[model samples]
Target: MAALGWMVLALVFLDEVLAAVAAGVWGSHAGGWPLAVLAPVVVVAVWWAFASPRARWGGPVVRRVVKVLVFGLASVGLWVAGHHGWALALLVFSVVVNGLAQLPSIRGLVAEQERPPAS
Candidate 1:
């Protein structure tokens, strides 16, 4: 489960890096430098907010809620900003893939808490 979480996180980070590069190149050419910077900033901020140690025990509820909220906001932002079509597609894909990837760990954690200890 820990490995899965780390893998998902690594993929998410890679996605962010790719998106940032795409935004920086395309956005700058399109006269949207703010987006080029904002893309990476938002990625870093989301990682810090939800993945930080303070949030370690926040549990599945918090994790899922944060994931949905952040992804939804990011999707909407992409749609509104009207960047590359591929960027929007990639964002949506990452959201769904990451969400699915984390579900097993979240369910396992929940079940572990619910189970009674053996005598």
Candidate 2:
């Protein structure tokens, strides 16, 4: 479960990077240099505010919600950016893998590891 948690974290980062790239590409097509640069900055800011490990938001629920939103939107963004096959693959991978991580047994396993041992 801990390993899965790490995998999920890595996936989250990948999703964010893909999202930033997609946004920048879209911006480049729609506007120009400023928009291209600003798109990634905005995406990163929102991600840091709502999805980062130290996000100033709710608990696990909020984090999960943000994760879904971020990855889902990024999947769409990838499709729009002309990577249809990659987008679908990412969507499927994120859904199935994240779903597994949400299983109660897996969550409990991860939570158990997070606890400090009693003296």
Candidate 3:
């Protein structure tokens, strides 16, 4: 279970990176060079500000919503960018993994791993 928890944690980070890629691709399709360059930057900035683990802004609910939006938009972005299969995979994987991560047991395991060892 602990190992599974850790894997889930890793997946969460991977999901974030993929979401940025999706956003970048979408931007390139939505607009040309400038937006292509700016889209990922904006996504990263917003994640850092409100969705990242280290984020200082927003309450838990707000953070969760922001996270969902990021992932949700990523799914949409991939679809709009014409990567239909990828879009569906990301959508299902993100939803399932994220939902599973919220389970108390998994959260506890993740938290335990994050805790500093006894001095």
Best-fitting candidate, scored by TM-score: 3
Candidate 1, position 67, lDDT: 56
Off by over 4 Å in 1: 1-9, 16-39, 52-58, 103-119
lDDT of 2: 0.73
Q: Estimate each model's TM-score.
A: 0.49, 0.67, 0.87
Per-residue lDDT of model 2, residues 18-61, tens digit only:
76776777667557889889877887887788876567863677
Give model 1 RMSD, 1 decimal. Answer: 6.2
Ranking by TM-score: 3, 2, 1
What candidate 3 gets wrong by more than 4 Å, as runs, is 113-119
How high is the lDDT of residue 32 in model 2? 84
Please list all clashing residue pairs in model 2, or write none if there are none: none
TM-score of the candidate numbered 1? 0.49
Per-residue lDDT of candidate 1, residues 17-107 (tens digit): 5544554554445457786677657655665667433464446577567655655555555555565586577677777676665586754
Alpha-carbon lDDT of model 1: 0.60
Which tens-of-lDDT digit does each residue in 20-107 have in candidate 3?
8888899999997788889999999999999876688967887899999999998998899899999999999899888888889888
When 1 and 2 are scored with lDDT, the better candidate is 2
> Model 3 clash pairs?
none
